[model samples]
Target: MTDFRLVIVSAGVSDPSSTRLLADRATQRVSSLAEKRGHTVTTTVIDLRELLPELPAAMSSQLLGPRFTRAVDALVRADGLVVASPVYKAGLSGLFTSFFQVIDNDLLIGKPVILGATAGTARHALVVDEEMRALFAYLRTLPVPTSLFASTEDWTDKALGARIERAGRELVLLMESGFARAVRDESWDSYQHSYGSAGGTELDIDLSSDMMRLATGGSLRDSDDDPFDPRRA
Candidate 1:
């Protein structure tokens, strides 16, 4: 029963937002599990709609600097994260997407994030899985195996409740693993930044020359290896 904090990123309107509902349910499941383990749990809920015109896509990085900074801070300080959003026109809400895009990717590296979403039908569930995973991938976050999706019908569905419980457990397990490994690996991650700046692979000089040689009928050679023979290693 260690102390753990969970952050919910919900992009939903103030009304009966299915996004926040699903997120709340998921958090409850995790909090219950935490209680059972005698662990204290704290939560910070950030509703993108609550963020207002400040969260507009184009200005998300600037106007919402404090909020955006808090979001990044939450990712760093929290043991795990649950991101829930309502689908919008076959895509994730712009607020959610922009919020993520503006952050420092290093904050999410190796963090366990649970992907969840709500929509009118079940058909869009897989979209969250694939597209959402891609986003986490870019952030270098380790996503849990169980992704939560709630269709309009799922709001009151019993099975959906069970699924939320399962996702919560899965997320907890991932975070626990991270906690254990992070202690040992934290040094490496922290010091890795002190090394050389982001390095792209060196230009393949050999390949470049080979291609040129082929393109010009062996005009380019391995000059480094054999200057006279016109062949460079």
Candidate 2:
């Protein structure tokens, strides 16, 4: 049986947060479904509240504390992800967005992810699909077709559970297909990646390139070449 790693990032701030509750439910379903498919699933939970102390440093100086470092490590190794956030002022929690904003741009590329969000009122239900999906899209993550959003009333509603089940199954199917891993293994170079990005595992560099030479204070043209010649320029 193939083994898969799943990471759950919960931006819940309360002890019994609905946000985390939603995320946990999704995680459980995904695990169960994957197990039924004869796959082993390992999970890592990253509670964003625990990383609050590191957020400022991460945002200000790009310094990752121990917990933040661990979070990034978990994300890098994750085969699939369940990300849940709380809504505030008609938008996603600042803590939720901030944490992702500080990570490498290519860290989540091609990774299968499920978007979930919790808000007090049903009015904010669209936040997950409208805002959170956009953020994951920018990271180039492959979010499942089903998105989960829960309001206070949705907690007891059967519809929320249905969505969670659908999302979980979708995630499991995507993971089983190994789409993300295949994309990374086969077409990784086709994607745009910044230097030292992807949690610093992307170390490939072409020393002979003009950009590299210029960055290292090396001249593109040799001393023997004519300085003003268009052919040598």
Candidate 3:
């Protein structure tokens, strides 16, 4: 049986947080589904609350503490991710956005993600698609078609469970298809990547490119080859 690693990033601040509960439920569903398909799943959970102490430093100065470093390491190895955050002011938690903002942009490229959110009122149910989806899109993650959103009332509803199962199945199928790995292996160069990104695993640098040469104070491209050059104009 093949093995996969799943990382759950929970932005829950309370001891018994519904946000984390939603993520855990999704995790359970994913694990069960992967097992049914003859695959083994290993899970690593990164509780954002635990990174609060380092959050300010990370946000302001891009300083990664031990906890932040560990989170990044976990994500770098994750085959899939379940990211859940509590809704605040009709949007995702600041902690959730802040954590993702500080990480390397290339880290989650082409990775499959399951977006989830928990809120007290159903009025905020749209936050998952309206807000969370946009964030993951910007990160260039492949989010499942079904997203999970649980209000206090939704927790007891059977629909929530069904959605969790659907999202889990989609994630497993994507993993089995090796979409993320294929994208990274074959088409990574088609996407924008920064040096030392993706937890230092993204070491591919085109040192012979004109941009690299220009950055190193080398001679510019020939005026005939530069569309924007004043001489060409």
Give the lowest summed-lDDT range of ten residues in model 3. 224-233
Which lDDT tens digits does candidate 3 get at residues 1-233? Answer: 77999999999999999999999999999999999989999999999999999998999898899999999999998899999999999999999999999999889988899999999899998999989999999999999999999989998889899999999999999878888889888998988877888887889779889887777765487878877766565
State the C-alpha lDDT per candidate.
Answer: 0.72, 0.93, 0.92
Q: TM-score for each prediction?
A: 0.75, 0.92, 0.93
Model 2's alpha-carbon lDDT is: 0.93
Per-residue lDDT of candidate 1, residues 94-137 (tens digit)? 77887777555455567777789888888888867878889988
Q: Compare the candidates by lDDT and give the number of the best one.
A: 2
Per-residue lDDT of 29-88 in model 2, one digit per residue for the tens? 999999999999999999999999999999999999999999999999999999999999
Cα TM-score of candidate 1:
0.75
Among the numbered candidates, top TM-score falls to 3
- Candidate 1, run of 10 with poorest lDDT: 194-203
lDDT of 2 at 17: 91
